[model samples]
Target chain A: MRARLILWGIAALLLIALPPLATALGQPYYVDLARRILILAIAAISLNLILGYGGLVSFGHAAYLGIGAYAVGILGFYGIANGWIHLLVAIGASALVAAAIGAVSIRASGIYFIMITLAFTQMLYYLGISLDVYGGDDGMRLKSRSQFAGLVDLRDPVAFYYVALGVMLLFVFLTYRIVNSRFGMALRAAKSNEARSRAIGFPPYPYRLAAFIIAGAMCGVAGALYANHTGYITPGLMAWHQSGEMMFMVILGGMASTAGPVLGTFALLLVEEVLKGWTEHWQVILGPLLVLSVVFFRRGLAGIFFKPDA
Target chain B: MALLFEQLLNGLQYGVMLFLMAAGLTLVFGIMNLVNLAHGSLYMVGAYLAVTATQWTGNYLLGVALGLAGTLVVGMAVEVIALRTLYERDHLDQVLATFGLILFFNELIAIVWGRAPLYSSLPPWLQGHIKLFAGSTYPVYRAAVIVVGLLVAALLWYVVTRTRLGMLIRAGASNRTMVGALGVNIKLLYTVVFGCGAALAGLAGLMAGPIYAVQPGMGELILIQVFVVIVIGGIGSIRGALVGAIIVGVVDTLGRAFLKPLLGTMIPPTAAEAAGPALASMLIYLLMAVVLAVKPAGLFANR
Candidate 1:
């Protein structure tokens, strides 16, 4: 635990100093990339809640991200610039959808669960595409950065980067706390053996559903941040590939650990960045690498620092 | 009324296409217990190869044969190289690895075919329309697709029900250990089954090429729908796949054709216009959800 804390502390310090460091090095683009990575790390962390701990392989988690983003984009379209409102709507809407989807999906197990989640997300994606008022398939740009009533101008790159970093750290700590709590124990217990958990007076459905909703709501926040960071939102955000990539991040970071997904997000995106610089057809390389990693790199980058499921 | 009849035919054709994809998917899942997302990649491969071969040989039939053969070989190679080791692993690993394969296939296709959509023209004999009723006319090529799909389904039914291979497949699905113990070559059996599944997907892809834009990611557009069919049909059941695919196809096509005008009469045109297309697109997903709520195992779930 001490080592884990120190590791995160050093990581946090570096992130806090990233903007100034990037500026000094005359690589401002890195700050934007860092901010984007931090936002996605939040998403990866949320995925880990149900995936790593609760053992629910929701292949459509990106739907919540898209939902969260659409909440911000739609409200902004209607001239509601309140950042707090965007955050609230993002969370509330995501939770509601998750509840509905989870209520139906949690009844099924294994491949059925994965496919159901995926289909529902695709349903949402199609809905997003058909909403012409929201720019439909082509997507739309944010009119402006969300206003926070003078707390901090999201337009300022450094300010936004710090905000994203702060939020990411907060979620990492939050997930850590949640994973150690009674609810977390129940969630994990259900994951290892649902039948045993039920025999022990803890039915897995309610616990699993609750975790799914929490993860959805958390990812929604990440989505909201993503909209602001990119200043645009599209239905493509919820595509199955996004969900796949998020899963890869969770697996890459090391499942069931608090900071593992954060590490994962960094590794995946950084590698992709380097590969993009190398060639336009980077996916050809990344694809086989992902396959090989799943086959051989079972423990993930987090496995090097922490024991499995530690 | 004639329009409705024509739309129903469209739905049937679409469903028939879906069954081809779902049959292979369901068979693989039911027998091998492996979820192969790259099954759609095989579909794309078949379409690409057929299009390129058709262009090369100037004979559509020969090109199609070549495409089917190529997909079978690719499927067997994949089963031996990538999937053989995966049967023991968890579903999560299988999903990720196959997803990686999807990325590889899509990009490779793009590199070879370029990003633009490829179009294949039907032969002169298949180019005209067939008058089905007083006012409804369906394309001859589409009619041929329906006929072909039905023929394949019937053939599949016969093979699985009457043939020695079918008996072996059924036995393997129920008790692979016993089948292996009885001196069946399980590894070779898996490869053959996987190859047949790929060929089925390839057939669907080649059929779809003329009607749909053959593009890098075209396989995925239909793959999720195929997943819905499998889910609604009951995983591992060919009968379930057929029924589920038809239901989804009919429901989807009819919903798109009628939902707009139906809604327009009750609500404002603008609202109906916006809601109709969106709801139509989501119709099958909603259906799958309802089915799950009522029958979580699906309509024809044997297990």
Candidate 2:
């Protein structure tokens, strides 16, 4: 517990101090990297809610990202410039989509659930491409960063970074709370053994569905932030591969805990960037790296760091 | 009416192709209880190898035979090297490891094949169109695909029911530990089953190279469809795969062929035009969602 607390303290300090450290080092690019980490961490953190805690390995979690992003992009296309409106639309649209998908998909368990979630995600992805009005197979681009009406200017990179950081921290805290609450217990119990959990009279459906919604809503926020971060939206955001990458993050972070997602995101994305810089065909290296990670470190880096023996 | 028949044939051809892929997948799942996400990667490799082999050897059939062998070898190798360790692990672990393999294969293909969609052509005998009825024709290769798919399906059914190897495979699928305890070489049986499945997937890819773009990540595009077939069909049952594949193929093809006209009558032409293709692509997944909703274990799930 003390080690976990220390690890959390160190992570908090590193993230908070990253921008200044990067600025002092004259590598503002690192801040952008940090921004990516925080944004992706938010997505992974939300995924951890379903996958790590609820034992629901959704192979299409990135669909919520697509939904959240498209909500912003569609609104922006119509000239709805408010950031808050983007958040509201992003959250509401993603939740609605999640609810619909979860309502259908929750019927299937294990691999079926994975495939069903993936199918819905691909459907959304194809829908994104078929949207010839937006950009079709290419992708849609935003004209400007979301406007905030003098409250929180998202146009500034650092300001947006801070906002993303704030949102990520909020989600992390929220997940911590959810994972510890009675709902979290029920969700975990259902994950460990469904029939027994049901026999014990704690029906797992509502809890799983509720966790799915929260995770989807959280990822929706990340999606909205991602649109603002990249100043673009594309069908690629909702691709099943992207969902797999997020899954890698959650698993690498150590799925059962909140801090694992943060650690895993930082490691995986940073390793990705480093590899891309070193070689053009980085995935060749990253792929084996991922295999090795899973093979050797099943509990993940956070799992290792937090182990009492270590 | 003739066009509808052609569309139906197209759906049948597509469905058969899905069966070849899903047959192997379902077998692997049924027998090993492993979710090989990289099953698609093997398909992609088959296409790449076929293109390369065809270019190297002037004969297309020889190239295809070689390609299938190569793909089988690679699949067995993957099982031995990477997936062998994962059988004892949980499904999530299998998923992650195979997911890693997908990235590996895609990038490896890009490096080796230079990222271009390899051009492939059907043999002269397979290239011509076959006239079905008055003024209606379908590609001979597609017809061949349908025929081959049916033959393979029948062969699979025979092997699974008649052959001793098939008995072992069936036993393994039904009860792994029991089969292992019964003194059968479970590991060899697994390798053979996995190789056979890989060859089927390879055949699907090699055949597809002539029809679809033979490119990196091509496997992933069709893989989702195969997954849906398994879901709608039932994961472990080959009969379920056959039914699900045909249903998905027919539904998807018919939806694309007929949906626009039907929707145009109900909605505006522009709206129908815009929504048509998207809805067509979504048709199979929608079928899968509906099927899973109605029967979560699928239509023909073994257990």
Candidate 3:
């Protein structure tokens, strides 16, 4: 428990310190990248809730990112610029979509769930493409960054970076708490053995559905942050390939670990950045890298670095 | 009326094309219990090979034949080399590994064919329009696609129901250990089944080349619809794939084609125009959701 508290303290300190360090070093680009990394980490952590803890390998989790992004983008296009309002709309929209979809999707286990989630996300993608009002295939651009009512300036890189960091840290802390709670125990039990969980007087359905909704809402937060960061939103956000990438992040990070998603996001982003700089056909390299990771290093980066305590 | 007939033909053609894709997907899942997300990559390979073969041989028919052969060989090779190792693993592992293959194939295609979309022209004989009824003319190639798809479907049905291989396949799906205990080489059977699935996807890709743009990301686009078809039809059931594919194809194509006009008759024109395509595109997903609600295992789930 002391060690856990120290780890959280260090994490909180790092989150508070990093952006300022980047700005002090005159490396604003790293700050921006750091901010982007935090947003993805938020999404990945949420995914870990369902995938790592609940053992529901949804291939379409990126749909929540798209839902969150579109919520912000569509609302902003109609002249709502408050960051809190956008965030609320984004999370609410994602939770609603997740609930509606999860009601049917959570019925099927394993591969069917993955495929159904993927198919539903694609439906969202096609809808985005067909929406003539939202720039259609070209995508919509934010006229300005989201506003925060005199508390912070999101348009300022440093301020936005800090805001992202603060939010991410809060989410991480909350996730840590949730995973150790009664709900988390039930979720983990369901993952290990659904039949056993049922035999023990716990109905797996409601817990799993609630987990899905929470994960979706968390991803929605990431999506809203992403739209504000990039100042653009497109149908590409909801594509099946994007979902694949999110799953890749969860697995790469070591699904069940607390810090796994953040670490995985950093590793993947770094690899992508470095490889793209080195070669035009980096995916050829990346494909094998990902395959080998699953084949040889199934425990992921976190598993390699930090052995979980029994 | 003519327009409606034309749209119906278009829907049928699209449905047939989707069956070619979905059948392979369902079969592999049914037989091997493998998700095979990279199946679409095989389709892309088929289209690329067809384009290359046509250029090399200077004959469309020769190109088509070579494309099919090449895809079959590659499919078998992939199964023997990569997928064989994956059969014993869990579905998540399978999804990840196949997804890796998708990344590799897309990049490899881009390297070989360039990032630009390749334009594949139909042969002159297949290019012209044919009159079907009263004065309505349809593209001969599309009509040919429908015929070929139906023929393949019939051939598949016969092979699955009337042949020794079909018996083995059914047995493998239901009881793999029992089939193996009977002295049948389960590994070899899996390889063959995967190869067959790959070939089907390849055929779909080759046929889709002239209809849709052959490009790096094309596989990803069609893959979603194929998944929807398989899900609604029941995973691992070819008959379900056919039914699901046709239902999705007709709904998607017709929805895009006449949804606005149909809605305009009932609602205001502006709202109809705005909502038609959006709702149309969502029809299949909505259908799938409804199906799942009623029958969570799917409509024709092969036991």
The residue ranges of model 1 lying beyond 4 angstroms of the native Cα positions read none
Q: Per-residue lDDT of B86-145 in model 1, one digit per residue for the tens?
A: 888888999999999999999999988899999998789889998886867889998999
TM-score of candidate 3 relative to the true fold: 0.97
- Candidate 2 per-residue lDDT, tens place, A1-310, comes to 6866787778788778888888899999988889988999999999999998888889999999888888889899999988889899999999989999999888778888888888899999999999999888888898767888877888777787788888888888898888888888889899889899999999999999988998899999999989888888999999988999999998898887768888899999999999999999999999988998889987887777665111
Give the B-chain TM-score of model 1.
Answer: 0.99
Q: lDDT (CA) for every model shown?
A: 0.94, 0.90, 0.89
Question: Candidate 2 — which residues are off by over 4 angstroms?
Answer: A1-3, A307-310
lDDT of candidate model 2 versus the reference: 0.90
Candidate 3 runs further than 4 Å off: A1-15, A308-310
For candidate 1, give the DockQ: 0.92
The numbered model that scores best in DockQ is: 1
lDDT of 3 at B217: 72
Docking quality (DockQ) for each candidate? 0.92, 0.82, 0.82
TM per candidate comes to: 0.99, 0.98, 0.97
The per-prediction tally of clashing pairs is 0, 0, 0
For candidate 3, lDDT tens digit of each residue in A183-215?
989989998888999999888999999999999
Give lDDT tens digits, candidate 3, residues B128-190: 999988988999999999999999999999999999999999899888999999999999998
lDDT tens digits, residue span B1-303, model 2: 988899999999999999999999999999999999999999999988988898899889899999999999999999999998888888888888898999999999999988878889877899889888797899999999999999999999999999999999999988889999999999999999999999999999998988889898999988999999999989899999999999988998899899999999999999999988888878888888777778888999887
